[model samples]
Target: MTTNDPAGDPAAARGNAARARSFGAVAAAYDAGRPTFPSEALTWILGPGRGLQVLDLGAGTGKLAAVAAELGHHVIAVDPSPEMLEVCRRRQGIDTMVGAAESIPLAHGSVDAVIVGQAFHWFDHARALPEIARVLRPNGVLGLLWNDADTVVPWVRRISQVMQGDCQTVTHSGGGDRFEPMPILEGSNLFWMIEQARFRHWQDLDRKGLRQLALSHSAVAILKETRREQVLEQIDQIYEHTARPPEPLRMPYLTDCFRAHPSEFANYRRTLDSPVAPHL
Candidate 1:
C-alpha cells in the first residue's frame, strides 16, 4: 500500500511524485508570475504582533518572509532549491536555509508560528505536521495560503482555463490531505465556501521572462523541448487573445487564506480511547 502526504489526492499524488522531486527552472518565474499574500491575511495569521518567531516553510524567494519581517516578526525561510534559495538570499531581512516540509532542519519547539504560502500542496503533511507541531510552541498557529488568479472575471477565468487545461489537478492544498475530518474548524478557523480578495499589480516581460514563467511550472518544463515549445506557443496564443490590439499583459490574483490552530483539544480524543477508564 502507498500513501500520499498532507494535501494531495491519492492518485494525483502518485502522478505528481516524480515531478515533485525537483523545482529547478521554475524557481525564478514562480517568484515572477506568482502573487503575494494580502496584508489582511497576514494580520489574521500573525495578529497585531508584540513580536513573533515565525517560520516560512517552502519559502520560495522569501516573499512571505519579507512580509513577516515587515510585520515585526523574526522570520526564517526554508526551501529545498539552492537556485531558489539564491534568489531568496538577495531579498533583505530573511534568514534562509535549504529544507523541505518533510524534513525541517531547525531545532524542536523553535517557532511561535508557521506560515506556508502557495507551496503547501507539495508537502507530505503527515511527516510535515508532526515536524511542524514539534517546532511550534504549544497553541501556535499554522497558516496555509495560496494566491490564485481571481478567475471570476470572464477574461481571467478564460485565461486560467487555457493556462491550466492540460493539468489534471487544478485545486490544491497541503492541509487538504492531512487536516480535514479531524474536525472542521469553524468561525475563526474556517473561511466561507468561496472567498476572494484582489490586488493591483504589474509585471514587465521579455521572451526570456515568458520562458522563465513557463519553465517554472512543474508540468510544462517536465516535457521535451518540442513539446515545451508547443505548450509555450499555446500560452502565447492565449495571451494574445487576452491582449486587446496592443496592451502589455498582466495577470490578476485573489489571495486565498486558510488558517488553523493546533488544538489542545486532540488530547481529549486520546483520553476517551485510553485503556484505563476513570469513573465519570
Candidate 2:
C-alpha cells in the first residue's frame, strides 16, 4: 500500500493499524522479560513533580507502578489487560485499575501526576492527550516511557530485524532510541519533565522466551496465530545464528521518559475554564 502524504500522516496510519496490533499474546513474557526503568531516570521524570497521588497509565505488568510506589507516592496502576493486571496485583499495597489511557478510571483533577511505561506509543495520543489533560490538576504532570533494546549491538540488531516483522521501520525508527519530545502536544501536553537513561543488564531467556517477548508487542499481536508461530520459528533461526553459547540470551534496553502538564487557557479563561483531570 502507498499513501499520498506519508510524512504528514505517519501517526494517523500508525493509529489506524495499531488497533489490531496485539499486546496480550505475550503478556506473561512481557512482564517477565521486559526490563524495569533505571532509578535515575525514574527520579528525573517524577522526582521533581512529586504529588499527593500518582497514576501509572498503561501500567503494564506494574513496572512503573513498582518504582512509583517506591517513591512513597500513592500510586494507582491502570491497564486494559486482566492478564497484565494480574501481574501488577502481585505487588503489595499497589492499587490496580482496569482502564485505557484514553478513558482512565480516575476522577477529574484528582491526581498529582500520571506516568506511563513502555506503552504510550500504543495509545491514540490525539484523544488520550485531551483525556489526560482533563485529569491533571493545575500544573499537574504526565510522564511517558519505554525500554527498547540497544540494537546498536550487532547481535541485538539482527534479533530485532527478525522479530519486528513488517513493523521494523515504524517501531525501530531512530535506532530504537528513547524519546520525550513534548512539543507535539503543545496545545494540550505542556512540558514538565524531560529525561534520558539507559539500562545495560541482560536476561537469560531461550529462543522461545525471546520470541515470546516479541510476540507480546502490539505490532506482533496483530498476526494470525499460525503466521505468528512461523514468525517465532524464523526468530528462532536468527537467535541461533547470533548466539555464541546457543543458550538463553540476555536483552538490553535504553529507557526514556517524557513528563508534561495540560496546557492552560488564557488568563481570563482560566478562572472559568480551568480544566479538571477526569477520573472516568
Candidate 3:
C-alpha cells in the first residue's frame, strides 16, 4: 500500500513528510519524555472487549501498545520509522511492523480495533481512513487519542507557550487542540457515531525529563543544533521559574479520546465481499 499525499503543493507535502519522520531521530527521548495515555481513557476506548486483536496504528515506541497488552489485548504496533520500531521491539509482547497509517501492512479485517496515539494528524487522512476501514471487522471501532497540556494552569500555559513559539508550529504539527472536536473524524464518511471523552492526568518529571519531553517534539527535534539549544534553554528557564530543582515537577494533562465504528454501509459492503459466511 502507498500513501497519496493530500497536500496539493509539492513543497508542503515534502515538509509534512519530513516532520512526520523527524521523531525517529529522537526516538529514545520521545519514549522517555512522552506521557502514557491515562488508563481510564484506554478503558473507555476499548470497552470491556476481551482478548481482542488490537492494532496500535503509528504506535511510537510502543506506549499505547504496552498498555493494551497489559489489559490482555493482543497488540500489533506499526510505524513508518525503523528507529521508533527498534525501541518498540525491545518491549516484550508487542508485535512491531514498519508501516504507516496510510498504508498499513495488516490484512483485511485482521484487527478487532484500531487505535492511534498522538500521530493521526500527521496522516494523509484521505488515504488512511479507507485503509483503516479495510483492516477492521464489521462494527470494529477506531480510537484516536491525544495527551494535551492542561494549559488552564498559568505556569503550564506559559511553559506550553515557550515550547510552541509564535507560530504554534509544535502544536499544529503535534496534534494539539485536545478540547475541540476533531475535524477529520467529523468530516469523515467512513466512520460514524463518534463519541469523545477526556481524562485528567499528570506526570511527575525532573528537569532532565522535562527537557527530554520538549526536545522530543518533532518541531523541536528537527531544529538545527543552535536553535535547538536555544529552545532547550528557554524550556529550562521556564522550568526553573515554575518549580524548584531536585523536586519532581507535576505536569498536568488532558487525555482526549474519540472512538467510533466503521460506517454501516461500508461495513455491509465488506461483509458481503468476505470469503466467509456473510455477517448480516
Candidate 4:
C-alpha cells in the first residue's frame, strides 16, 4: 500500500488514479499475468471458519474471490470496472457487482468478512474505511492481501528494478521487519487489532506470460505505444538473460495477508446508526 510519491502531491494523486483505472484496458493481460493467492493465505485470512459470506471488495477478476469460493464460502465480487467485472463474472460461485470502495453496494452488517486483494492501496481510506466498517457484521474480519515479488532473490531484484524504470526499487509491504500500524485503521477506532501472516509462492511464466506480466502493470500499461514497446523490450531482454530453455521461469512472491477484527463498540454504534426499511 506504499507509494513512492509524497501524499500531498496533486499530480501524483492524479497519476495514481490513472494507473489504478488503467487496468480495465488490460484486464485480460492482468488475469493472465497476476498470480493467484495461495490457499494457505486465504485460509489464514478467513481463520478457522467455514461457509461464511465473503465479500471481495475491489475484487479484480475474482482472483481472491475464486479461491475463497473454492474453500466453500459464498463470495460477492465487487469492482468498479465493467471490463474487469466481465472477467470476474465468468467464475463460478461468485456474484459480481460494479462498485467502488468509497461506496459499497451491500447493506450494513450484510457480510461476514470483507477481503481486498492487492487493491487496498487504491482506496481513499478516510471514506472507504467507514463504508467497510458499515458493511461488516459484528466480529467480522477485514483482510488485506498483497503479492510482492520477493526481491530478496538476486534476479528478481533486477526485474523489480526494470519494472520501476531503474530509478527506484519497490519496497515490500505488510510482512517487513518494521511493524507500523496503519494510521487510518488505528485512528478510526473501528478495529481492535491487526494481525499479519506471510506465505511464499511462485508463478511459472514463459516468454509470452512474461510479456503479459509487463503489459499488466499500470505504469507500463498506460505508456504510449512506442514507450510501452520499449519497456516490453527491456523486460524481454531481462527475461532472455535470466530464463533458461525448457524450464519455465519461476517468479517468487511473498503473499502478505492481514486481518483485523471489528471492535464491539463500533459494531454497536453502527447497528444503532443503521436505517430501517419502512413497513408497508
* Predicted model with the maximum lDDT: 4
User: Once all C-alphas are superposed, what RMSD does model 3 give against the true structure?
Assistant: 4.2
Residue-pair clashes per prediction, in order, are 3, 13, 0, 0
Residue 100 local lDDT, model 4: 98
Top-down lDDT ranking: 4, 3, 2, 1
Model 3 steric clash pairs = none
Cα lDDT tens digits, model 4, 1-280, are 4433323356655666777899999999989988899989999988766788899999989999999999999899999999999999999999999999999998888888899998877776667888888888887899988888888888777766666663242232322322223665677788878887889999999988988987877767777898888888888998899999789999999887789988877787787989522211
- TM-score of candidate 1 against the unseen true structure: 0.75
Worst 10 residues of 3 by lDDT: 170-179
RMSD of each: 7.6, 4.7, 4.2, 3.5
**What are the per-residue Cα lDDT tens digits for candidate 1 across 133-172?**
5566555677766665556567556545544546644334
**Model 1 worst lDDT window (10 residues):** 173-182
| TM values, all candidates | 0.75, 0.78, 0.89, 0.90
TM-score-superior candidate, 3 or 4 = 4
- Give stretches of model 4 more than 4 Å off: 1-9, 166-181, 275-280
Task: Provide the overall lDDT of each model, using Cα atoms, as 2-decimal numbers.
Answer: 0.63, 0.65, 0.80, 0.81
For candidate 2, the lDDT comes to 0.65
- On TM-score, the stronger of 1 and 4 is 4
- Model 1 C-alpha RMSD vs. true structure (Å) is 7.6
Point to the candidate with the largest TM-score: 4
lDDT of 4 at 119: 85
